[model samples]
Target: MQQAINKVELRNLQIEDYKELKNSMVEAYSELKEAYWQEEQIERLLEIFPEGQLVILVDGRVVGSALSLIVDNRKASATHTYEKITGNYTFSTHDPFGDVLYGIDVFIHPDYRGLRLGRRLYDARKEICEKLNLQSIIFAGRIPRYAEHAKEMTPKQYIEKVRAKEIHDPVLSFQLSNDFHVIKVMKNYLEGDVSSQEYAVLLEWNNIYYEKHQQLINTRKSVIRLGLIQWQMRPLNNLEALFEQAEFFIDAVSGYASDFAMFPELFIAPLMADYNHLSEADAIRELARYTDSIRKKFQEFAISYNINIITGSMPLLENGNLYNVGFLCKRDGTSEMYSKIHITPNEVFYWGMKGGSQIKTFDTDCGKIGIMICYDVEFPELSRLLADEGMDILFVPFLTDTQNGYTRVRNCAQARAIENECYVAIAGCVGNLPKVNNMDIQFAQAAVFTPSDFAFPTNGIKAEATPNTEMTLIVDVDVDLLKELHEHGSVRTMKDRRKDLYQIKKLKS
Candidate 1:
């Protein structure tokens, strides 16, 4: 095999590299007096917590090192000295179950000053923190070279200058660039230290990848605003007229500052201009023909308005087969389709349409969501599967001709929300189109729902438009509150699921 040309590698420190490590430390910190760690201390650190000790090598030569130890943040105070915190460099305060990773030291050889080896060491420490599920990494970063400008400004003034990009301190500047924020300045942190003027700055980097058992709470802009439109039946006109109407509603919702705008199932029913002249089967096929053009327009609106839009559901034609599909258009003009997985009897007998075979969830900036059409929301298994896969919200677009038909979809939607502990929003078509044959009549009411828990609304209805009316409703749903309900609700529906007795697995694709 050819010798690997990659010169740099990171690995755990070994017991045999103490001599080289001592020499490297001396070469890296040559300007400081007595800065090298003792051989016994290095050996002890490797013996007790070898995983926390990392070494950087260039062609098998140890050129840099980073050491860390876990410490309980509760026991640490705002003004503790370095010697008191680390137990005189022995790290006797290391707690295995602690939530914070304390940085002991980091140094690179003089030859590796501009190679960014220190940044590599810091990234390695972050990787360790994530793997261990640590909350954050805290360190007493030095203001090295501050002694050169100590008489010119105080420590606070120096930090402000470094933050404002007016002046730079070697260690503090590097830490700030690496996403570390200064917490406070520690007095008498290191005795007799010329660098930092014997004062060290406490800094922290939160491990965002860490998974905590507690629910996540958001303090800033926690709600996702949704605009649901209950479209009224209109005459079958040209495609341009239909598109203009959709843009009208989308523009209206955008003015209200909605994050996501949703329409009803088959909201494009009025665009089927040639339906009355053809048979029922031909009419359904005609609807599929407009899928591509409508999809492009929907994406354009999403990008132009800078709002995410769901095209309730469209009649799509795929490889000579007709399917009821919905297009989710993101703010960047990207889109994905979700075909209705449960076919109704009317669709099967009259239109010869088949049900979709696959189910999927979409991740958005608002939240993780699953889209279901009219009849799909009536099935418990589909929504439960989506909830199990970490769906926090479910969107349903329905079309019903009678009050009884509307009640079925609305009741089942509420049941799914309660059972899954997920937010459910339903939008539907209203009014009647007498000349449109099968789509002549519609009775609907748009509603946003939530779980019937203390954390959520009491009756599970957040907002609802009147039945048999043309209207739009904009409501806010909190994703963080859904997380809270999943973990600590009055009745934990997700957690209380009896998985031991029954397992519902998705069929192989």
Candidate 2:
């Protein structure tokens, strides 16, 4: 679908369709006097299972088919580049693999020339590469060059002379138009065109092809302010009025990609009067309903605005037990939820609940991000585990006390970011929600953190709820930069890790 124009339907080649495809390829190869066509080869190809061999069909006929080569080097040297490149390297330059070595074989019936079936067949091959985990697909194709006139020469001399001939031709124009590079050439060794013992030009499609493949990957790199919108709201009553203050903040940042949005510790509270007086069973049941609703509503707003939201601590119920939680669902449908892995002594003492143990990270179209809850972030292991998994952005949602606790969390955030070479976001609830007996005080402000080893220029912050209001904060992420930090270059963090000695220590465990 990327830059497509024709109506060619591509599907796996069936055995029933094989007769037509093999017949077409053999005939096409015959034109060049190549001996690759044979009945024995067809039988071997059948062993691959026709369902896996793909065909490019137009109308009801098979115009093109790919004869793939499978090389399983599991019993031999398996880690070499050549072994990895051409899955199970079959040196046979005859049937399908030869075509693979020569690049994907595309023989459009001469009648279907202008229909653009060539590109469709190539896409089929790319899919094959993905299933096998091939790093990069390389194509080897022939370019034609003709000599001006014949001359007296010996067998080798004649072939060498023919190879020496050079011409700026039409197919050569076609190949270059498609971004193929001319790597080399030969004599009397290619399919189609004037053999006249003519020169065979070798062309390839490498990473530089750039023929509309990467166009769909949102490459827009505009700097946008992102907010860790943590609100200090007491509780949501009647869900509507409770959302009033939070909605006001979202409305203000509504128009721009730069907006502030957030959710605090238990944004919704039941009956708002005396929570402590309620039995634990009743309290947990009410919180469970609130958690499910919060997840649904939070997803809608994030998707509707195409914004980034770190929905703060909600009550998550797994089985019948309830735990505090955090979520970061981008404006897209992609959502990630993190249960509180570390519990405060007070919470455990009072609620008699356990904590989450695993650290989960989500890969977004934007970047690789991880979430840790309130008290869990204090432990170095939580962030360390996420860092080990290649997290580029880490979000920590907490219920902070009046001191704002920015410096405290920010310190931990900075440490984690520096250790992992990633960015960190910490959001905290801002107000006190008092029920019959006890007051649950949540800190109000959130902060953004970057690796301390590098310069941050204080990246833009989205509109977070102010000192007193509940709000939704939105921010744009610079995913491109995050990608760079993960890969190699001047500041390649992954490369900076000396895994040899580190692996020994880890292996001991």
Candidate 3:
């Protein structure tokens, strides 16, 4: 297998490999520098990585292994935490969407030392990312001496005590050797003891510094029906076949006067439940190929239908890391793209990519709009950011199952619209998807959620498709009303703020 070189094959380790990997990790780290680490604690690490990507080498007779966990560079997400740390608020409803990566836990075997195996394993993980095409790889480093890797070290700490994790862990050294840059020092998120403080070092590897757009746009409201489609039960094994299924479903309502449409997270790829049996690296690479093909199809669909179609979440190969990104195209062939900002824990654990840069709202002939995929809308900071930046209609595209989730999200959409006084539209999938592990716990049915301003049921159900069915919701957005509401109420949330007065401090070196 190409995965194995120098008598070493980088195969994804399974539950069976957990014991060996953990032992190897403890031996290697302990030998380098003694530390107190439990077998169960290491076991939790195994659980965190589950079965994603691994490298196993056969040196002479013994087999050695290494594993990598894909963590998000979600540095500076908790503005609420900042208020507590800095003794003042950092969030003024002005800005949000943190661009940080916590690429942690790259474990290797002790017996596998010498022969530059450590660098080889690091390069291999990076190579896997390159083969698949992703955005960036961020990892967390220990503090103190690692302060060189942190956002900042407080004056008090600078004069006295040293931070432990930043100084003790070898991740900082490992990442620096790999050309990863330290972006910030995370403050007060992870909890341990007060004596040995823990601070997350945001490290990133990217050619382009992904940026956020905070500019507002002018929009008008009109009636429009939109559909969020999720065709479940498929852990998509074949890209061609999956795309065909999606094409068939969308083609059914192509000629209708629908203004827009969407799909849910992993909309174009497979959803494997069990990590132990899969190599997410390969899966992500495969999904990238599918995204390229599907995006072109989506553009063609927009041109043919003479509408603005919003393509749902797909793995976007930016550089070497695959990002959960969405695409928007108009009939004229022009396009806009939005990368997901707030990622779920599972997503970060599975893929080594960060969310988007900013809360960008695009101004189009159709309307002044913005989009937040699935979990993105769950963060209040993001909602406040969009409103602060002046967006009219926010589109939430999702793939949800379980009535509880549907209700929570559906109600949340309305709440945001009421608070922001803008328009809200959602597209969802309704079906039973086979889990990579459970194969049960199917998703809820699909529907379109609209805001209250549109007469009765203020939560407008323009034209919601039935859950567990193949369909599209079509309606016109009243961009004018959205503009009117924003001018009067929704836009007032940020009328007062003092940016320079508050110090946005992170637990520093």
Q: What C-alpha lDDT values do all the predictions have?
A: 0.86, 0.55, 0.56
Query: CA shift at 456, candidate 1, in angstroms?
Result: 1.5
Model 2 deviation from the true structure expressed as Cα RMSD, one decimal place? 15.2
Looking at candidate 3, the ten consecutive residues that score lowest on lDDT are 87-96
Question: What ranking emerges by TM-score with the best candidate at the front?
Answer: 1, 2, 3
Across 1-509, the per-residue lDDT of candidate 3 in tens digits comes to: 12354565556655555556656666655623433234554355456544434546564322444444443334323322322321232212211122332233455555555556567666666654443333455544444343343346562343223323334434455566565665665655334412215555555666231224322553222455454555555555565666677766566555665666666655554534333265666556555666767788888877877767778778778777778888887767988888888776766776666777756677766656778887777665676566766676688877665777677677777677666656677666555555443224445444444445534254455445566665555555555455444333323433434556642222321
TM-score attained by model 2? 0.51
- Candidate 1 has its poorest 10 consecutive residues by lDDT at 213-222
Q: Is candidate 1 or 2 superior in lDDT?
A: 1
| Model 2 CA deviation exceeding 4 Å by range | 1-212, 217-225, 258-261, 269-276, 279-285, 334-336, 402-407, 434-440, 453-455, 458-477, 483-493, 503-509
**Per-prediction TM-score, please?**
0.61, 0.51, 0.48
Task: Please identify which of the two predictions, 1 or 2, would achieve the higher TM-score against the true structure.
Answer: 1
TM-score of model 1 (CA atoms):
0.61
Over 4 Å off, model 3:
1-221, 230-237, 271-277, 435-441, 448-463, 487-509
Give the alpha carbon lDDT tens digit for every residue of 316-360 in model 2. Answer: 667867687767767776667777877777666655566865566
Best by TM-score: 1
